[model samples]
Target: MVKINKMLKSLHISNYALIDTVDITFDNGFNIITGETGAGKSIMLGALSLILGERADIKAVRDSGKKSIIEATFEIDDYPTLKEYCLANDIEWDDTMCILRREVAPAGRSRAFINDSPVTLDLLSHVAMQLVDIHSQHQNQLLTSPEFQLRVIDSMAGNDTLLSDYRKRYAAFRSAVKRLHEAKRKIEQNRSDEDFTRFQLEQLDAMNLVADEQEQLEHEREILSNMTDIKSTINGALDALLNGNSNALSLLSEAGDYCEALGRILENADSLAERLQSARIEIQDIADTLSAFDSDLNADPAELDAIEERLNDIYALQHKHHVSTVGQLIELRESFRARLDELENSSFTIEELEKEARRAKSLAKELAAQLSKRRAEEAARFEADLRERAMPLGMKNLQIKVELTPTELSSTGADSIRFLFAFNKNQPLMPVGGTASGGEISRLMLSIKAIIADKMQLPSIIFDEVDTGVSGDVANRMGAMMQSIAANIQVMAITHLPQVAAKGNAHFKVYKQDDEHSTHTRIRRLSTDERIDELAVMLSGSTVDNAARANAKSLLNIK
Candidate 1:
């Protein structure tokens, strides 16, 4: 026996629709829910859908005074990745249990939670998708959806790895193509504005701006502006030192001579004479240096004008570039040079990217071809299996075909798939969507879903009246198929067929009751005897007779 590792443990709904509170526990087997029409089976489904992050209307709230809460618990020890997802998303979860809860308040607001940690609806839906697959009768319309059909084919072909690789290659090709187009656009835009670029470059070149040149020019300008005062001060200092007769140097020389004469008679007179001589020598050097500066201090107005012009040019360049200093302008110049270089070599870059894109496209095409080949091979097996499965379900003359026509490469690959069908013996094959009756389509969809259930490792599948137009052996076979699927995962069917209901390992009945104030929907797990009674009632329309009881007993195999 296959070890059943995953299943929905229980669902608790409160104040949703006509259900004040309906709590049901489920086991890891084929659990069947049966009720008469308008008995609120669909309401229960709507509640489950809310926990799955489906939107709920305010009318779904049974009471305007309280909030509606729907919660589901799942045994997910078998789904390790789901646990990893919780950890990655920082959600609190356990190895043995995963809880999903949704609440709608009377104020028309809603919230979702995973393990009591608040979460967004999208995340809840993502996690819920991995937990349960609700296959309703409405999904039969997916037969006409090409994307759905391709996915069906791909699932059977086991194309996950190949399709992933092909998509990666396709993404790379697209990226390269995008780069090539951008490069071409840049080249065209730059060429259109090339004249402005060249003009700016020429202006910067003519200015001949240098690093630190502005500071140097400013110093020169200041010196020229003060040349006359500087020269006058230097000349006056030179005249006082040497040109005048009573200058400090002359006085010091006379004093030095007197000290030398007195040195012969005094003790410290020789030391005093040496200091006076040294002072006189330093004074003479200053006088000579000042005279040289006076000669060189000519206020050339033309040189000053040249300096001002150079400084102004530097300032204008700074203003144009919106920069603060010459260094920033220099950096901007280099950037312009780089853009020009790229524009000049745009052809080379475009060629390289195009080559890369083409190589990636070729690789993607090759992988797509391999995917197509695998799908073609699997289509044959798919056709054979559908025929075998459908024939047993009263589609004995069902000519099922999977046609693959070549098409442009896509995320799924380069194939257009159409499921063809012909129910009559002498009829021509046509599209399954147009040719098959509603009953036949329902059966066909079931066969496909069953095959998929075996291929995939899902936790649970809930079929909501998918067996709408089948009876007798066909319903029995449908139930058997559900049972077979349940051997690997949990299967739940919200059904009304007695034949289908009789095959459940566990059965629940949903019914309505009229209390004093309002009508309420309730669900209860049926006992074996109760199941017999319910099945008999279904077989004989509430008037259970001896023959209906016998037939129900025969269906349930009661001794």
Candidate 2:
């Protein structure tokens, strides 16, 4: 028997319900815990649940003023995959050990940590699931669930990659179908508005709108509206400069003649004469410009009417489109054109989506068929192996069958599975949940766990009184099965049966003690002599006797 390297090493719990503080160190192989009912066994499991990321309740606090904390330590050097997961999640990874801790404050707030680094509860749970599998009596009800049944078969078939591929294909198929449906809906809706959109686009195109056209046209309209005032202002400026200024050019000419006469007597008079001549030339040019303006300034009613009509058309289009600028109206027209184009090409788009959907569906169907074939082949072996493992636990007449019914393609696959069972010959097989009693279910679950333990490489498994309703040789056989499973991984069982308790490499007893203020639950590892006494008490109803001790020693294989 090879020992598993990755196993839970120790647990520390403090200030939790019914437990002030307790530190438990577990062995690597089969470890047994025995205690009377209500002796804090369930409390211990609850504390363990905290480290597994279960929701923390304020009611579980032993003292309302203090915080409750639970921590678990595991050796994980052999699990490189777990190391990779931690590194990928930005969690600090330890080479040889990983510690998981949960803290619940008195204010009902909770926090989780991995290797002392803060983490979300979801991340903690994801890592913890890979570390431990805690199977309780309540899980027996899962026998009725088809999902769980199918999961068990898949595990046996080693269908992880195949199932992942199938689900990916199925997801693609669903997406394609969704896109096709959306395209069809949009096409139908756009078809209803097609005529109106085309009309709007045609109207805007016929107008031949240009960006900035509205601003330019408004400036032109202002000039045309005030034409008489603008023309009068220009004529007044022209008369002041040249046309009516004593006629300024004539005045400048007289000044130049006087300066020419003075030049014979005075030297500066000649430069003054040149200046007056230049001034006369400037005035003449101004007179010529004014004359041209007068000739071109006549107001034509016909051209004004045309300009007003064009402006009115632009204003009407802006008002109709609720736009203030020609640019905005242009954008609206393009949007209408685009919508019409989509309506026209909708058939091609729908056809392309249909092809994609068909391709995805075909691939999904092929993968689902492969998954179904693998599941079918493994289902037979799983049934046979379960029958062999369960027979020694007083289920010799157990007739087990796996039924796979074809289902439509889904995330899991294209099959629905159920475990059918009958405990006696000539009895009709029915679903395990309906046919198996509580004890039978317990035994069956244990057997299933035993068969899958090696395949799963589970580091540790805790069975919380899974040996609920069996005794004598059946209990002994169940213990033997657990011992066999422990060879490959860590196994912990909390049981009351002496036969089962005697098979452990290490044993712990949970008990209650009372002080003056309150009662406390404590657990301690039992020694060799203490084991005999505990087993004797369990066998003889709290009374230890020579015969019970002999029976316990015999069960423990002591001489």
lDDT of each: 0.87, 0.89
What CA RMSD would you report for each candidate? 5.6, 6.3
Best by TM-score: 1
lDDT of 2 by residue, 398-436 (tens): 999999999988899889888999998898999987788
Candidates in order, TM-scores: namely 0.80, 0.74
Residue 52 error, candidate 1, Å: 4.0
Residue 12 accuracy (lDDT) in model 2: 91
Cand. 2 TM to true fold: 0.74
Model 2 / residue 549 / CA error / Å: 6.2
TM-score of 1: 0.80
Q: What would the per-residue lDDT of candidate 1 be over residues 1-559, giving only the tens digit for each residue?
A: 4657778999999999999998999978899999989999999999899877788799989999999999999887757788888889989988888899999999879999999999999889999988987887565786777787788888898998899999998888778778888888988988898888878877787776799888899999999999988988887898788888788888999999999999978987778899999999999999989988888778999999999988888888898889989888888877677778888888888889889889988998999999999999999999998888878888888897889999987777789988889999999899977788777887787788778876666658899998887778888898898878888789999887888888889999999999899999999999988999999998989798889988999989897
Model 1 segments more than 4 A misplaced: 1-6, 53-55, 78-97, 117-123, 211-307, 426-428, 457-459, 539-559
